[model samples]
Target: MVSLPSTLERIRTRLILLALFLMPWQTRWIFGTDTLSGGISEFGVLSFFVVEGLIVLAFVLQPFIEHHRDFDGAVTLGWVMMLAMLASVFSASNPHLAMMAWLHVLGAYVLFLNLLNRHVKPKEALFAFTLGLVAPALLGVFQAVTGSSPASTLLGLASHDAMTAGASVIETFSMRWLRAYGSFQHPNVFGGYLAVGLFAVFLFLRWDVSKKARMGAYAVGALLTATLVLTYSRSAWIAFVLSSVLAGWLLFLHHRVELRRVIPLGLIILFVMGFTATLFSNPYVVALEETHPGREVYAYQPVHNLYLLMLSELGVIGTLFVLLWMVLIDRYIFANLPRVGAVGALAIGSALFIIGFFDHYLWSLWPGLALVAFVLAMTLRLSEPGVEKE
Candidate 1:
């Protein structure tokens, strides 16, 4: 023996923690280009990511550590959705681009479902997640205060000038203030992450951690909040405020909800995902960037609504699978309302859904997908067996 750990389990554990921490933080990615623009257009496509690599590695090693087991029913449903997404690409203008996008989706879904089935402890997972956010908060604050963002290829950062045409900024009579991007593609995406991930700080409070940890949580919360405000993303702000208020009301003030009560939310999201199929849309919208070559298509914007975005890209067949996935997940959580983590999960999902109403990132962007994956994994804790009811 080389004196290494006897099993791959130890390596798997460390990889899991590292992946969780990095998944929600700033991503380190590089895009290879065959074009003159040096691949800005292929930012998401033809991209290699550090976190995605780690997740795939961990997933590959997973079978070695466990005994033969039946497929997790919930995870299987996610796979079905993935298959539908693939099937939807049959008619895409650029099926290759669609394939890459589908891979990104699969990575996110795998991350979500795998974390749900794992046996990680709450305190450890929470700490890894909450701390993962601190660096982004600090960097975002600096960018906002200075109104300058420097590019670093190694760090996967791109320069942002407040005076630039496409730069996200706040314009007032006094000056055009720069918004914090926080290593994300957009300020809104950054704000979305903070709004949802900031709750992890509070969730950790439930555990009896040390004084230092408690103070640290308070500090992290403050930092994230500062950056969130600087991002000036109204959608994120609304999502956070509304989700907190509603979850608090339903979880504490209201009586325990039965499964019947949660059914409507599922229908709502399902309806939204399929709603675009009922309306007319641009024929080439599904793979616009790839379909138009040698064009500055970054200026193009997708539909702001997540539902509309999904319907446009995924087609009716794919949208239906996603809707079914939502229905099943909703019914499951709602059935357990007032149980361990049901309300908390619902609140986070609601916040995300609300953000989708005003922003299309959760369905379109890689960073946004990573944000969802991290939150879903973290929040799945509440749904675990034996979580005490409030």
Candidate 2:
């Protein structure tokens, strides 16, 4: 029978998994939205505060109870990022909003780097990630097919009022289709989550798990990939293709696998690309071809690059800090790549960098930032001794 202490530990582990699983869903209370002019406004989410508080409590109590100590460069970078973000709040247009955003970053850092890596196993983390994608993936499929979803006030999910003929969807190819947003603020953000989940599922497949688990991973991957197509996020589509290739190549290098095995993965990516091209008439795709005017609050021409967005919003010094943090974390991951294996690191990093070059989700969305933290934690945990190797 389990001791009382062991039972309590088990409960803590389950809560950590639950928090990780809910990271992507934007069910929250919006105090205000950022204006085009880079004003920071308060945006409160009950789930964010609750989960983060629990993580912090667990982190603070763990040393006294469990007497465990582990430290790495990734963890150091995470703290640095939190500090940088807090400092940047002073110069933000809305200091209140900036402070709130910093809090969210803090939560992400603790949950992913502190709680997840230290307590959760790699397989458990992967299972949580795959489970997290299920609701959004299914919702995306439904939105694509029906062209709308009812707003759920309790869940904080908005309706599809913007997906009209000339607004979100395009009518150029004698057809119209709604882009999938899932429960996110935009279709592209949802696609970003799916892109990351795709890689996570790929990593899961390489694990020495049961046949049933492998099959489940395959099903999740398929659902995520299909919904990603419906999102019509050109940046995400391109990122997925590039990241999939990098992951396959890195796997081959790490395992000395035969080229034949990698070919099937490449073919699948090609098929996804082909399907994306069939939706060339999507307004989001068309928006890429033309120079659209920037929304009033943003104060710049409509540009997709995340670096540019950071520069515009955070200014040179803040942007430098942000970039430096990214570099440091990335360096830490690659430095330990031999231990962690390259598939997960390369796949997630490739997708983020590629999509980041063409989109601003990572810079502007709290959920996007959280996803990055989660990926980094999962990557670091997978590198530890006793974890499976590809």
Candidate 3:
């Protein structure tokens, strides 16, 4: 039987879930015109703040709702180092942005601790969290097909003015028309976003969800993947491939359950490969000046830029620390908390890491920072006993 506090905690948890799922819309300023940052969209502004508030609420209620804690000292240390590095490395780019990013990380950690401690059930968390991504995935497809129509207009296509502007931009000069960036600033970011969504939906399919839920997940995943390809973002393409491989590997891990699953997935992959080969031969892919710009001058931009992004914005020394920090976090969680949910979170983190290869999520202070924090908190909380995970 649930106590009054526990019942209230559940309500709070539900509200927090609603807040998170609403972040993209609010940040994007979808339904409303007013925002916290003057006329600027509220969606972007709320993404970090809403998630942060939820974290605080969770932490405050943790003791009341949870009976135990599963945070490993090693993981905690890594997280601390990660936070410190972000503050130092990103200071040069924009100190305020850097600090905000760090704060998001901190907030996520608090949220993670609370979740692991038992503020929310695993199924509730998964459904609520995945719903957030799913909405954006659908929106992205809608936006892309129609050409990023005005924030208000859902269909038709983006205004001719916006498309012209997008085509004129130097960074995306090669793009023929506007692509759906959804609430994000760039097509690449949207692609990365969809990649993570694909993973979540794919994972759901493998879980004990109803046939309808599983089928819906598969459809959403496929739609997101197809829309991502339409973005024509090379980075998103790489992320998708890596995400697909990871999901396939995870699905195959329980090989004896269904050999039929692996067989069809394999064939589909082969077909995709052939299709990709044909597409690469198209003059469009070959026409680009450089797949990744500015790399030719330094040749170092590939590795050095990422390192600089981590160090200069986070600090030189701090960037180096992340390797140890993440490893420690992985080891501690895997060693003491062997739940499937924890494993799934780690896998998702890995998918994001791959996504980071092309985009600089670590460079911002909102969604990226919040995402990392949420991942850590989920891992820690799911490790605790009495929690049904993944």
Candidate 4:
């Protein structure tokens, strides 16, 4: 998108932003699936989604875009990851599943590279993302308030009956309600999206934009925060809260000498999480599994933890490389991203890492994968130094 003439580049930026704005819609075409319950499991299906098509278009355009060579570390890590995923296919429990997973991983890696190379501004990226959240957030709020989820093929919603065995719902002693799913396949997915959406809006508000823009961000943030609660996704709730605290902490300690304090806090948080997981593995696994249609070990479920899921998918060597990749990315040049933007990016990255400890969707599911890539590219770009005065 960057190599075009100035006028053309501007148009292309609009188009790319449009793609980001529409990327969350779940519309797709299914090619095939593995038989589960005499039908294709949604997870096992080979489908080409609308978002995937947009990503493919961007991928195809990537070679033509001009790039700065400042991101050798990120680029090298991407290639290493692609290689690892390609290798993992042979050893995966299901070859077809593995290939599909690899394909999405490749997409995510490509998307991350594309965004960073093209140089989308932090505010622009945040604006596009939060704008995209509007429709889904509104729909989610409606679903939560009415306790109904009407089917709409075009909108990517399926009718959700709380009484259905496979439906996601909240049950109290006297009443039960369907958890809002928006256009996502599950409430946790919806909540996860909203959690980040809220963060995006929060950051957008902090920028010195027009009053009207700030008002819009406030409205969207409120919607996202309210609907996030309705989804009742504990993982998403924790992710949002931790992200807020991390952001505030990073901002407070942006100085290099003070940044070291993050290490101990991070270590303590990890130790507590690890201990809690170990102490409650039995009931925690049960609760995690019961959130969806139950899965037997034969059918298999990705471990609730993202790190464990990565270890399983990528093996020890691959996982080690992935960890190294993350470290390398953090070392990428902090270009023109404003100080606040950079701190916000770092905080969100930490949040994602923490969420990974409790959820696998960012690695195991398509929507989760794409959304992570989206946020990650923004974070990567924002990490670059931008200390411009308003």
**TM-score ranking, best first:** 4, 2, 1, 3
> What tens digits encode model 3's per-residue C-alpha lDDT throughout 186-301?
66656665655655554454456676775566556556655566556666567666655654465456443533533443454445445534542233244344455444421223
Candidate 2 all-Cα RMSD: 4.7
Model 1 misplaced stretches (Cα beyond 4 Å): 1-6, 24-44, 64-71, 254-302, 387-390
Model 3, which residues run further than 4 Å from truth?
Answer: 1-4, 26-48, 61-70, 82-98, 152-162, 166-175, 246-254, 258-307, 332-346, 377-390
Looking at model 2, residue 73 earns an lDDT score of: 51
Q: Which of the numbered candidates is closest to the native, going by highest lDDT?
A: 4
TM-score of each: 0.80, 0.81, 0.71, 0.81
lDDT of 3: 0.53
Which residue ranges in model 2 land beyond 4 Å of their true spot? 1-8, 30-71, 161-167, 173-175, 254-303, 312-317, 337-340
User: Looking at model 4, how many pairs of residues clash?
Assistant: 9
* Cα RMSD (angstroms) for every candidate in the order listed: 10.5, 4.7, 6.3, 7.7
**Worst-scoring 10-residue span by lDDT in model 4:** 276-285
Tens-digit per-residue lDDT, 1-390, candidate 2 = 888766667767777778668765666555555553554322332234344655666555452232113345545655666676677789877676677767776766666654443456767777787788899889988887787877886665777843464335533434556678887878888888888888777666656678777666666766787788888777888888787777666666666553343354445645754675564445454543343445332222356788787788667766777677667656656766654344576677778888777777776667776777776666555554556642
What lDDT does model 1 reach? 0.67
